[model samples]
Target: AQSVAQPEDQVNVAEGNPLTVKCTYSVSGNPYLFWYVQYPNRGLQFLLKYITGDNLVKGSYGFEAEFNKSQTSFHLKKPSALVSDSALYFCAVRDIRSYIPTFGRGTSLIVHP
Candidate 1:
């Protein structure tokens, strides 16, 4: 079975500070990892993806993630956080057996002004 876990339900950070959202995954075979963001009542927007390349993958909105195969983790990171960066984030994984990816429950990132 393939699954994704976002340990945090919410992350509160002040503007101009670095932020990170934890994510861990389990899969049977090779996994395609992805990060997505969603605003209120809006569909998820792709942030980044790690297929097979460098361990560090950058994405939209100055977001980046580190893929650690041994730890089975892909944690999202940003050096500086902004008020507009506040949004709901979801981590997903697609296994070789299936095309559809399994998404995490979602972590709310509140970047206060």
Candidate 2:
């Protein structure tokens, strides 16, 4: 079975400050990791993904994630956060053998002014 955990229930940051949302995953075989952000009453929007290749992957809205195999982690990062960035963030992992993907509980980000 594959699973993903977003350790923090909420992450608070001031506008213009860097922010991070932590995620760790477990899988039996090679892992496919992804990050998504959701606004109020909106569906999840794709942020980034790590299937293979470089350790660092960049995505929409000035966000990026670093894939660490040894640590089983793929934490989302932004050099500077905006109030608009506040939303529900999710991490998902898919195993090559499985057709379905496992998603995290989601972490709420609050960007304060």
TM-score of model 1 (CA atoms)? 0.97
lDDT of 2 at 54: 100
Model 2 root mean square deviation, Cα atoms: 0.5
Q: Could you say which candidate leads in TM-score?
A: 2
Off by over 4 Å in 1: none
Model 2 / residue 69 / CA error / Å: 0.4
Candidate 2: misplaced stretches above 4 Å?
A: none
TM for every model, in the order presented, reads 0.97, 0.99
Q: After superposition, how far is residue 86 of candidate 1 from its true place, in Å?
A: 0.7
Summarize candidate 2's per-residue lDDT along 13-77 as a digit string, tens digits: 99999999999999999999999999999999999999999999999999999999999999999
Q: Candidate 1: give its CA RMSD in angstroms.
A: 0.7
